[model samples]
Target: MAIIKLSAIERRRLSAFATCLVLSVFAWLFTALSSQQKYKVKLLAVFKNSPQKRAFHSLQPDSIYATVQGTGWKMLFSRMNGDDNKISIDLSALENKNYVVLSTQLKQINAKRDIERQVVSIDPDTLYFDLSNRLIKRVPVRLVTALNYQQQFAQSDAINIKPSYVTISGPADVLAKITYWQTDSLILNNLNESFNARVNLHPPAEGNLTVLPKSVTVKIPVDEFTEKTMQIPVKLIHNRNFYDVKIFPQKVKVTFTTSLKDYPDINEDDFEAVADLDQWLQGYRVLTVRLTHMPSYSKIVKIEPMNVDFIVKK
Candidate 1:
């Protein structure tokens, strides 16, 4: 086959024609998109200024379609920005009525928006609410945490949260089912010192729930732990025949770790070790030594002799 090549003059003429055609297409598109027109966009419905005397729950979802009159450029820019666009609806009319007409508030809502984004109409023009008895209650706040401690460090005392409870107001049925509110996760790593911070409570995602003082102060005590050894006397119990039992190595070394602050206060009396005579009845020669009592904050490392030999004097 023979290749047909165009001369330089022919190539220049073709390039000029192609450039003109492209420019013409762009000009037409620019004119069309610049014209103002009505378009539908999905907007989130945000309720505001709720009735003070009445509690209400919306009958429809928070999403609604809004017919807005604006240029294609403006609409395109709005979409590129984000989808968080929302329309605020005034609910003060619910004090006397159970429904609100979206058209009635269109003027007020549009007052805060730009001239190009005049909302012409809204689908589901009417909004209805279910009214209920208003209830106010105080509930406890629970702190959620994911914490990691350094070696030889631990929580020393009970966690303290200021204003441990928060007041909540909502429909009676909704509030009745809620017993406690939770804070956002208090996550940390390699925590060696006490933690004191203001944690925010998770906001209610649905219904007309309201939480007062949305944040609280949390304080957690931390300290360095050191090992301590104590000799605790063992006592025998559960002899059905009331036989006098003697246990060898009457005292066992109890190894545990406690905070430095409480090390001086902790004594052998704070711990109780006992051996069960029932072990002999169960055909076991050695009785298991168990620590039945110890401080709540102390960590038991180990017992010197887990089992002890016991003799029964019949």
Candidate 2:
């Protein structure tokens, strides 16, 4: 290949020409973008002001198109940035009419946007709905939680939710199928103290259903646990034949953990330890001690004598 080297003066002239060419292109672009232009943009449709007598479901997509007039720069950036401007549609008309003209709402929709970019027209001009009989019902709210407690710590009482029920309004067929609404998961880990906060409910999965008061207050009681030991008398069962049975150990030490607040309330009377005499018929020499009843909140630590030798005389 042949190389043609330019002199320093020639190189300087070429650099100046390149700079001017770049500046001209930028100036032209600025002029073009400053002029007013019209373009299309996607606006999300938000339905509100639903009629009391009717429940309706939209048959069209949740988004609609708008022809907007604005400066070229705004139009270009609006498309590039994918702005999510929303237009709220009133549903009161559904009480007497089945269709809504979007053009009739152009003034309100434009009011939500910048004055420089006004909506000129709406595509498809009208919206239609599937009508149904509306029903309103009050339903219980179910709390959902995923909680992990620190060692020696546990929930001390029943969880409480303010406003245990919520009112739901929707199509009669839909509301008839819903007995209870569930809150979003309340997740906590390594919890050592009581919890109190407001949590959101799961949104209605169906577009036509609506839940009032989207959130609720939740309170959970927690406390540190301590071990308690008691001497529980063992009772024999299945001795219907009136046979006399004597076990070597008449009592067993029951150790369990209960919340500090509940420790004083729990007693040996709340627990029952039993040995089934029927086991002897199966040729077992020792009777296994089993706890037939215990407090629901207590966690058993150990039973000192899990088995005892017994003598059965008919």
Best-matching candidate per lDDT = 1
Q: Looking at candidate 2, what is the lDDT of residue 39?
A: 84
> Candidate 2 residues 22-44, lDDT tens each?
99999999999999888888888
* Model 2 regions lying over 4 Å from their true place: 1-4, 76-83, 239-242, 277-279
Per-model TM-score, in order, reads 0.91, 0.87
Displacement of residue 304 (Cα, Å) in model 1 is 0.9
| Residue 206 in model 1: lDDT | 65
Off by over 4 Å in 1: 1-4
Least lDDT summed over 10 consecutive residues: which range in candidate 1?
A: 75-84
**Candidate 1 TM-score over all chains jointly:** 0.91
lDDT of 1: 0.91
Q: By how many angstroms RMSD does model 1 differ from the true structure?
A: 2.1
Q: On a 0 to 100 scale, what is the lDDT of residue 211 in model 1? A: 87
Clashing pairs in 2: none
* Residue 191, candidate 2: C-alpha displacement in angstroms: 3.1
